[model samples]
Target: MGKGAVAAVFALLVVLVLAVVVVLITQGSVAIPLGEVVRVLTGRGAESEITRTIVLDARLPKVVAGLLAGAALAVGGTQMQTLFRNPLADPFVLGVSSGAVLGAAVVILGTGGVGWLAGLGVVSRLGVTGAAVAGAAAVLLIALGIARRVGDPVVVLVVGVMLGYLAGAIVDMLVYYTDPDRLQALATFTRGSVRNVTWDELQIISIACAVVLGLSVYLAQPLNALLLGERYASSLGVNVRRVHFLSLASVAVLSGITTAYCGAIGFVGLAAPHLARGLLRTADHRLILPASALIGAAIVLVAEYIAGGNGLTRTSLPLNSVTAFVGAPVILWVLLSGRSRKQAR
Candidate 1:
C-alpha cells in the first residue's frame, strides 16, 4: 500500500478501536448506555457518581492498559522478528514472556502475599518490573548470542524454547513450596488480564510505551537496513552491534513490562506484525512497527470486550484464552505450512 493509504487505514483502525472501547465500557451488568459512555468520556455525563466511577475509574484503566500493553508487545515482537530475520519470533517464543512470568512467580510465591507482585508497594512494583526486564534481557541476550553463532533460525527458536522451559521449571519449583494464596496471585500472570492493572501501573506503562515507541522510530532506519543482511547494513555504516543492543534491550523492556502487568498475553507480538505487513504490503519497519502497534491495540481491546468486561458474565474470561483463540491458529498455520523452516534456509 501507498504511505497515504496505509496512514488512512491505521487512522480508521484507531477510530474502530475507540468505538469498540466505548461499547465495551457501556457493557457489563450495569450497562451504561452509548450516550452515557460518550458523556462520561467527554466529562459531561449526567449519570450518577457511581456510574461515572464504573466507567471512568474502573473500566477505563483496564481498557487503556489493554491498549498500551497490546501495542507494546506487538511492536516488541516486530523488532525481534526483524532482528532475528524470522517470522516465527515472538515475545513468548523468544522466552521474554516466560522469563517475566518466572520473575513474577518467584516474587509472588516466595513472598507468600496476596495480589499481583505479592503485596509489593509502588517501589516493589518497580522492583518487580525491573526483575522482569532483567529476566527478559537475559533471555534476549542469550538468544542474540546464539543467533550470532547459529546459521539457522530453527536452531535459535529451539534455543529460545529451551530457555522458556527452563524458566517454567523454575516457576514450578517456586509454586511447589509456596502457599496457596500466593500461588493464586501468581496464577493470573500466566492467564493474563488487563483488568487487574492499577492506575499507578498504567502510568508506568504509558511512560515506558512513549519512550520505547519513540526509540523504535529512531531505530527503524537501522532495522530496515538490517533486513538486507548484516554485512549490507554494516556497509551502509549502520553500527550493527549498537543496533542489536538497542533493539534487543528495547524489546526486552517492552515485553517485560507488558508481561509484568498484563500477564503473558501471547501471539500478539507474533501475529500483529504479520497482519500489519499484510495490510501495508511491506515489511518496512517504519510502517510495520506503528501499524502493528495500532492493530495490536485494536485486537486486545476487542478481545477484552468479547471476554466480558468487568464481570458481565458474573465471571471473567482470562485474556490469554481469548488471545490464544486468535494466536494459536496463526502459530499452527506457521508450523504446519513449513514456511518457518523454509525461511530459515
Candidate 2:
C-alpha cells in the first residue's frame, strides 16, 4: 500500500474503533442517546443519573477491557507469527492462552475459586496475572524448544495444538473434580467474557498492557530481521537469543495479562496481524503493530456489539464464539495457501 493509502486505512480503523466504543457505551440495556453519552463522558451531566452510571461504570469498563484485550492479543499474535515463521502461530494456536488458563485455574481452583482469591488482597489479582504470565512463558519455552530441535514448522505447529489440548484437558479435569458452586467463577474464563472486569482489574491490565506493548516497539527492528530467518537475523548483528527472549517475554506478558483479566478470548491474536499485513501490504512491524492493535480493538468491539451488546439477547455470548469465526478461516487459508509449508522450509 502507498503511504496515503496506509494513512487512510489507519484513519478508518481509528474512526471505526471510536464509533464502536461510543455505540457500545451508550446503547446498552438502558439505551442512552449519543448526545447524553458525550455529555457524560465530557463531565457534563447525563440526561439521568442512571444513564451516567450505566455508561461510565458498567458499559465503559467492558468496552475498555475488550479494546485492551484485543490489542494485546493481536500484538502478541504478530510477534508469534514472526518468531515461529508460521502464519497460523498465535497465543491460542500455540497454546499460550491455554497455559495462561491453566495457571489461573490452578490459582483459582487451589485457592478455592474466586471467593478465596477475593479474600486475598490486590496481590492475589496480580498473582493471577503472574500465574498467567508464568503459564504463557512455560508454553512459549516448550514450543520454542521443540521448534529449535525440529526445523519443521508444521511439526511444531502440531505440537502446539497438542499442547493446547493437553492444557485444556487438565483444566477440564480441574473443573470436573472441583466444587459445583465454584464452577460459576470458571464460566467466564472458560468461554471468555469482558463483562466481569472491574476498574481495579482494569488498572492492572491497562498498566501491564501499556508497559509490555511499549517495550514491544523496541523489538520491531529485531523482529523484522528475524522474518528473513535466524541466520540472516544474526548476520545482521541481531542477537537471535536476545530477540527470541524479548519476543517471548513480550508475548507472554501481553497474552498472559489479557487472559488473566478477560479469559482466553481466542483468534484476535491470530487474525488481527494478518488483517494488518493485508491492510499495509508490508510485513513492517512498526506499521503492522499499531495497525493490528487498532484493528484488533475494532474487531472485539464490533464482535461485542454483535454478540448482544445491542441488548437484543438476554444472555451475552462468549467472545471466543465470535473471534473463532474470524480466526479459523485464517488458519485454513495459511495452511492451504502453502504459507505454512513455505515457512517450514
Candidate 3:
C-alpha cells in the first residue's frame, strides 16, 4: 500500500473507534442523547441526575476497559503471529491467557483450594494483576522452551493447546471445590465481562497497556527482520533470542493484565491481527501494530454492544459468545487456506 493509502486506512479506523465509543456510551438501556454523553465527558452535566449516573458512573469505565482490552489483545496477537510465524498463533492460541487466568484463579479460589481470595484486600486490583502477569509469564516461558526443543512449529502449537487445557482443568477443579458465594467474584474473571470494573481498576489497566504497548514499538523492526527467518534476522544483526524474550514478555503483560481485568474474553487476540493484515495487505509491524490495536478495540466495543449488559438485551451475554462469531470463521479460513501446511513446510 502507498503511504497515503495506509494513512487513510488508519485514519478511518481511528474515526470508527471514536464513533463507536460515542455510540456505546449513548445507547444503553436508558438511551441517553449524544449531547448528554459528550457534555458529561467534557466536564458538563446532563439535565437528569439518573442519566448522568448511568453514563458517567456506570458505563464510561466499561467502555474504557473494552477499548484497552481490545487494543492490548490485538497488539499481542500481532506480535505472537510474527514470533511464531503462524497465522493461527495468538495469545489465546499459545495459552498465555489461560496461564493468566490460572494465576488469578489461584488467588480467587484461595490457597486452601476451597475459599475465596476476597477479604478486605485479598482480591484487590493489584493482587489479581500480579497473579495474572506471573501466570502469563510462566506459561510464555514454558511455550518458548518447548519451541526451542521442538523444531516443528506445529508441535509447539499442540503443546500450547495442551497447556491451555491443563490450565482450564485446574481452574475447573478450583471452581468445583470453592464456595458458591465466591463463584460470582470468579465468574467475571473467567467468562469475561467489562461491566464490573471500577475506575481504579481501569487506571491500572490503562497504565499497563500504555507502558507495554509503547515498548512494543521498539520491537517492530526486529520483528520484521525475524519474518525472513532467524538466520536472515541474525545476518541483519538482530538478536533473535533477545527479540523472542522481549516480545514474549510484552505479550505476557498485555494479555495477562487484560485477562485479569476483563476475564478471558476470547477471539480478539486471534482475529484482530488477521483483519489488520487483510485491510493493510502487509505484515510490517510498524503499520500492523497500531492498525491491529484500533481494530481490536473496535471489535470489543461492537461485541459489548451485542452482549447488551447495559440495555440492548434483557439479559447480559458472554463477551466470548459474541466474539466467537467473528473469530471462528477466521480460524476456519486460515486452516482451509493451507496456511497451516505452509508453516509446517
Candidate 4:
C-alpha cells in the first residue's frame, strides 16, 4: 500500500481503539456513562465518587490490560512468523504460552501458600513473572535448537505442538494432586482473563512491554533481512545469530509476561499479524509490527466485550472461547488455502 493509504488505515485503527476503550468503560456492571468515563479519565471529576472509582479502579485497568496483552502478543507473533518463515507460527501455537503457564502453575500449585502471591506485594508478582519468563525461554530455546538441527519448518511446527501438549500434561498432573482450595489461583492460567489485573501488575506489564516493543522497532530492519534467509541476511551484513537470539528473547518475554497476567490468551498473536498483512498487503516488519499491534488491541477489546464486557451476561466467558471463533477460521484458511504447504516447501 502507498504511504497515504497506510497512514489512513493506521488512523482508522487508532480511532477504533479509542472507540472500544470508551465502549468497554461504559459497559461494565455499574454502566458508567460516557461523559463520566471521560471526566474520570481526564481528572475533571465524575458525577459521583462511585462512578470515578468504577472507571479508574475497575474498568480502566482491565481495558489497559487487554490493550497491552493484545499488542505484545501480536508483535511477538509477527516476529515469530518472520523468524520461522512460516505462516502459522505464534507464541500460543508454538508452546511458548504453554511453557509460561507451566512455570506459573509450578509456583501457584507447588507452594503451600497459593494465595500468598495475590495478597503479597510487587516482590511476589515479580517472582511469579520471572518464573513464567524462564519457562517460556526454556520452550523457546528448545524449539529453536531443534528447528536449527532439523532445518524443516513443518517438523519444527509439529515439535512445538507436542511441546505445548507436554507442558499442559505436566500442569494437569500438578492440578490432580494439588488441593482444590488452592486451585482458584491457577484457574485463570488455563483460560485467559484481563479482569483481575491491577494497577501494580499493569506497572510491570507496561514497562516490560514498552521496553521490548521499542526494541522491536530497532530489530525491524534486521528482521526484514532475515526474511530473505540467514545466509542471505548475513550477506546483507546482518548478524543472523544475534538477530535470532534477540527476536526469540523478545517473543519469550512478551508471551510469558502476558500469560502470567492474563492467563493463556490464545490466538491474538496468531491472528493479528495475518490480518495486518492482509489489510496492508505487505510483509515488511517496519509497517507490519505497528499495524499488528493496533489490530491486536482492537481484537482483544472486541473479544472482551463479547465475552461479557457487554454487562448483559452475569457470567463472563473464558477469553479463549471467544478468541477461538476468530482464530480457528484463520487456521483453517491457512491450511486449506495451501499457505502452510507453500511455507513448508
Best by lDDT: 4
The whole-model C-alpha lDDT of candidate 4 against the native structure comes to 0.90
lDDT of 2 by residue, 1-345 (tens): 788998999999999999888888877677787888889989988768888788878898999999999999999999999998888899998899999999888887764546666677667778788888999899999999999899788898999999999999999999888878767766777787888788888999989899988988999999999889888989999999988998899999998898888889888988999889987889999999999999889888888887785585787888888888888898777667686576789
Model 1, 109-160: lDDT tens digits are 6553334443456766786677788888888888988998996898999999
Per-residue lDDT over 257-313 for candidate 4, one digit per residue giving the tens place of the 0 to 100 score: 999999989999999998998889988999999999998999899999999955757
Which one is best on TM-score? 4
lDDT of 1: 0.84
TM-score of each: 0.92, 0.95, 0.94, 0.95
Let me know the TM-score candidate 4 reaches against the reference structure.
0.95
The alpha-carbon lDDT assigned to residue 271 of candidate 1 equals 84
Return the lDDT, model 1, position 86.
80
Candidate 1: list runs displaced more than 4 Å. 111-120, 310-314, 335-345
Ten contiguous residues with the weakest lDDT in model 4? 111-120
| Best first by TM-score, ranked | 4, 2, 3, 1
The lDDT values for all models are 0.84, 0.87, 0.87, 0.90
Per-prediction backbone clash count: 0, 0, 0, 0
Provide C-alpha RMSD values for all models, in order: 2.8, 2.3, 2.4, 2.1
Candidate 2 residue pairs in backbone clash: none
